[model samples]
Target chain A: MGPITGEQIAEKLSLTRATLRPDLAILTMSGLLEARPRVGYFHSGKFPHQIVAKKIQSLLVADIKSVPIVVSEKCSVYDAVVTMFIEDVGTLFVVKEGGLLEGVISRKDLLKTTLGGQDIQKLPVGVVMTRMPNVLFTHTEESVWSAAWKLITHEVDALPVVRKVAQPDGSDGYEVVGRLSKTNITRLFVELGEGN
Target chain B: MGPITGEQIAEKLSLTRATLRPDLAILTMSGLLEARPRVGYFHSGKFPHQIVAKKIQSLLVADIKSVPIVVSEKCSVYDAVVTMFIEDVGTLFVVKEGGLLEGVISRKDLLKTTLGGQDIQKLPVGVVMTRMPNVLFTHTEESVWSAAWKLITHEVDALPVVRKVAQPDGSDGYEVVGRLSKTNITRLFVELGEGN
Candidate 1:
């Protein structure tokens, strides 16, 4: 398709060029349209989702993951609650000896446990943690697409990125490397929008 | 690119046709790949986010918006809290005479108000409601992309889908039509994933 001039768009909409400038700026900045010095403007051939998907593809887990918020599996539910509020995160990665990924605990998990009226100070977080195999994870080489999918599908707010390492006993175990959350994705989205 | 046969893919991966069949079937059903009767299989040219974005584009606010969980502007904070919990929603639309959208009240707003230790049963929700020109909204004709963007950029969970209507006394006011929330977006994502 031929590049469209702002004049043409304004005319087609029966609007003044002044009235249309802001909307055009928004569309171009969002990557729905593109402008060239002399070539006028054209559709970017990228929809919002396409741009986001491309961004997700370009990002490696290592580039986007942050230090994981972790809790010892044996920590008390009360301690977990305090740690959660202190850390200001919605979920916590529960680990066993040597930072091995064991399970995950969410705000709801802690809330439900606390509401049970058990001795929160003595009750282990391990009892309420979402165990292995059920906990979703991403590896260093994986794209954020997979991580985001796990988030949307599992209806969870975060995932622990892990790496498979050989244990002292020669068994394979996952070591928590970092964490990925919706906040990271939103930050990336905002960055993408700036460049669009 | 030319279509590739299942046999070729299986051979390249060092797997039997039987072992690879189900995985191929899953990918095909997910809209990541396409199969032609005589031409074999080809990449579908749609990524995960593209599928989601397309779904968003095709959806109108009117189709997905839910009945607005609303409260009268004159309603007390205690009543608003009760209405929110009863409706099982995190936000409430505060309306004036004749259902004109006057303001918005969120759970956080109610919680903060209650924590002040004031008389909740007497203090009107309008006292704390986010008023006009501040409450973000969408119209029936708007796409889900615009709605979702408002959710992300404004960092709010729900939006009141509204329509501009002429007031009896001569100005214009917004009539709350329905509500759009993050849960709606996630539900749409799950639906897209099912056949993608």
Candidate 2:
């Protein structure tokens, strides 16, 4: 009646009991789920439907308040911190000659860059910036899952939700705007399933 | 003032403006984003982040639920449907005996198993299932972003969030509950940025 047991799992998977145990052990150690003695496995069921949705949105960078404090393609770490704070964000979407989303600079990236014993005053954010090749981005309209996918694969917290739009000067197209880490999906899930 | 001009993006992304045109066209057509030919690019500021999250979550099944339903793994398709509905989920977490997580089954898997000349009453969900060695999962307590990443990188929709814990016999641990699709993350973000 409860969750299927490990024994049940083995039968269902068509694998010998011995092989699957180790795999299960690794999972158990991570706290993703837990098992009871004889009763069977029980899901925490913490993250409900709504919370998952919220976490996905928080990672978006579009419509975020602008921080004009960032003066250059390479700004001071001091100024980067200021920009993030003023914008009430943890990361910054770095741009170049046009409004295209060039790269990203997070408080962590800036701090990590500075911690490397680099000259703070002379260093441009570009030096510490996660360049285009190194960055993970989503279109301004990618599904939350798509964005989440980029974050997880890139091992970063935010994604530049860029948009490729036609040019006014009779040029071609370009990217603009970005999405950053806006919410913790797990936390939101946990909260939604709180009362249930 | 509006989205960064295409010229800016070309310089920053290091790509020719022509090459990027298709991606822009596709994004706009897909309704994931919007654009202004002369002004700039813009998202609807109304994409249902939660629904999008749900759609993505639907893709993260590490196991196939349809197998059991099709094969009548000791039950009826009606029962399987009930299980799916009760869990408020569309996929079933497949497992092996001894509490190890196996492949997962989604509605698509079920339907596929019963497709064409296949008979639902006699088929096992496993037959049409996306099987092991290709299944993706998440660790217990992994970050939402990281978990979402696994779903994305692997092109999946859900993860069986597993963990290890005392097995009542005071032994070691085992795999347990699934985190599945995290819908809450998207929901929260959309609500917080309603009509943005």
Best by lDDT: 1
lDDT digits (tens) for residues A1-196 of candidate 1: 4587888767654669998686567556545568886667876665444544444466676777788989898999878877876776667999988899999987656644644547878989988899997889988898765676677777777889899989989987899989887656554443333333
Runs of candidate 1 with Cα error greater than 4 angstroms are A1-56, B1-196
Q: Which 10 successive residues of model 2 chain A have the least lDDT summed?
A: A61-70
Summarize candidate 1's per-residue lDDT along B1-196 as a digit string, tens digits: 4587988776655669998686567556545568998778876666554443444466677777889988888899888877875776768998887788999987657655654557887999988999998899999999766677777788776899998999888998999989987656655443333333
* Tens digit per residue, CA lDDT, model 2, A1-90: 246588877665566779767645533332223577886654433222333344444543333312322235767755665566556555
Best by DockQ: 1
Can you give the DockQ of every candidate in the order shown?
A: 0.04, 0.03
lDDT, model 2, position B136: 69
TM-score of each: 0.52, 0.33
